[model samples]
Target: MKFEILQFPLAKSAYGGIILPMEEENKSEIFQSPTQYESRLSRPKNQFAPKKIFIILFSIVIVGLIIFGTTRFFAGGKSEQNSEPAPTAEAFPTDIPEPTEEISPTQEPKKPTPTKIPTPKPTVNPVDKTTGLDRSNLSIHVLNGSGAGRASKKASDFLESLGYNVIQIGNAENFNYEKTTIQIKSAKEEFLSLLKKDLSSNYSLGTTSADLASDSRPDTIVIVGKE
Candidate 1:
């Protein structure tokens, strides 16, 4: 009888030998030789393969850890240097001045006293240019032609008050005179302006005659009028 070959490959036994079909167990055409099986089974087990792989992985892990530790150490040292505090300026003590006392003022300059001025007295005895005599020494006569009572006496008193010597007071020949007249010797004409200035305050002067008859007693004559 002829048996058919199996479609799948043969499996291995627990002892590492080929597990063939019982029909092919003695078939020399399909079975391997004992020496060939022995040759395959007798091959040396690679005992150092797992150990070499484990050692290579362990070396890689150890190299990574060393690199990581070195980087951490250097980074930590740099951070510590950067975190250090900067130096600050030192303080010094200041010198404070002590309080001083104020002094009072003394010995001020004195003020000067004002000087007094003297007042001058008026001249009462001015000299007359015409008579070559002082006004108080010249003789004057006052006559009233105004028909007013005591007009000549009033004029005589007024002339006397001005330092003239009024020797007489009387009435004129006619009382029809309109304005006062001043009659004097032609030599005494220089005194006319001064006498007019004095008499103009109380009398209105009219005709003034300096051609007196030269034999007249008084130096000047004042004839009082109604005006």
Candidate 2:
């Protein structure tokens, strides 16, 4: 620190035309007070601090508002979806009428029942050609001409055992035959051979006649005599 002294006319006029030298710092002190200078220097710093604080508060408010708006928007959309109605099943009708069948006006007449013509049942004659010469179809009448008791009956039983249909057994008109005689109806003449075959083992065969009428009920007549 050095000091330099200078004098101005205003100082000279005040000091009676004598010039004086003064330091630059002392001149500056003479123009401004220390309190005013100190206050002026701190003013920019105070204003800058308040501006930064204001900016931070404004950013925080803006972020909070944006977050609130976004949250509200999503919440409102979810509420709308939840509030919509769900679909339901349809109900069945209960009072439907039953269908009816219709009858026609012009029905056809019923056909008359066909008359059952009684077909003549086939007559199953015992001596038909179909039943040719079996013993069961040969009706026999035995007569004992041997004057022996039960001779005709024994002949009749023997013929029946051979499957001949023996219709009667009795004594003949006369006991004069000495051997067996066979008489057969012409309608049953086909059975003569079979009867001879059956009686040949038991009695000697005598005269044989095939002249009996066709209407005779017995197909054969036999007269038994002494063996």
Candidate 3:
């Protein structure tokens, strides 16, 4: 008699290793090598590789920021050196002004003039020609009929002081006479009135001549008494 050979179907495992199919009754007895089992277990660790690549890209970004900040700091210092300084204050002038004209010396003072005075005139006495006896040129005779001592001389001196021309001074015919009398020898009322005013009020008057002689007669005669 002749025998036939059978061929089985092949399949791949999850770790990319080759596997053979077995019957259900012998499935528990199937086994793999240690290397193959480790390979299959480490396959899950490859999923964390993307995390390391991200760390490298982040380090490059930080280095770019540091280089940009250093360039700006050096450029700002160079701009400050090229700028201008602030301006200083200006000063004022101190000049003085000159005079317009020169001064002259003072002039001398003038002299003063003198004034003149006038001379005065002499006074003249007024005259009345109606009476024969003029007041400025009258002849008077005084008698002391009262018999008092020096009475006639006293009356004569008084008449001379008053500007009268006393021709005689003597005692009367009688000393027993009571009141005094005035006799006007020239018969002039104006002279008579003037002689009466000069004598006392108690004395009486008459136009007739006294006991005197004609040659010894005066323009007016006054007789003084005790009354």
Q: Which one wins on TM-score?
A: 1
lDDT (Cα, tens digit) per residue for candidate 3, span 1-227: 88888888887865686778978776444555667667877886545577888998898998999999999989888888767566878788867787666444574455576666665433333243444455656677788887889878887766665457789889888886556676665444456566665554334443334343346557667777666
Question: Which 10-residue window of candidate 3 scores lowest in summed lDDT?
Answer: 121-130
Candidate 3 Cα errors over 4 Å, as ranges: 1-133, 201-216
lDDT of 3 at 199: 56
Q: Report how far residue 44 has shifted in candidate 1, in Å.
A: 99
Residues 1-227 of candidate 1: C-alpha lDDT, one tens digit per residue: 99998686687755688775566556654466777878888899866688889999999999999999999999999999999998998889988889886555775556798887776545466565555556775678899999999999999878877788899999999999999999988887777888887899999999998888789999888999998
Q: Give the higher-TM-score candidate: 1 or 3.
A: 1
Candidate lDDT scores, in order, read 0.84, 0.82, 0.67
TM-score of 2: 0.42
Total clashes in model 2, counting residue pairs 3 or more apart in sequence or in different chains: 5
- Give the lDDT of residue 213 in candidate 1: 77
Decoy 1 TM-score against native = 0.42
lDDT of 2: 0.82
Candidate 3 clash pair list: none
lDDT of 3 at 190: 53
Listed in order, each prediction's TM-score against the native is 0.42, 0.42, 0.36
Q: Of the pair 1 and 2, which is ahead by lDDT? A: 1
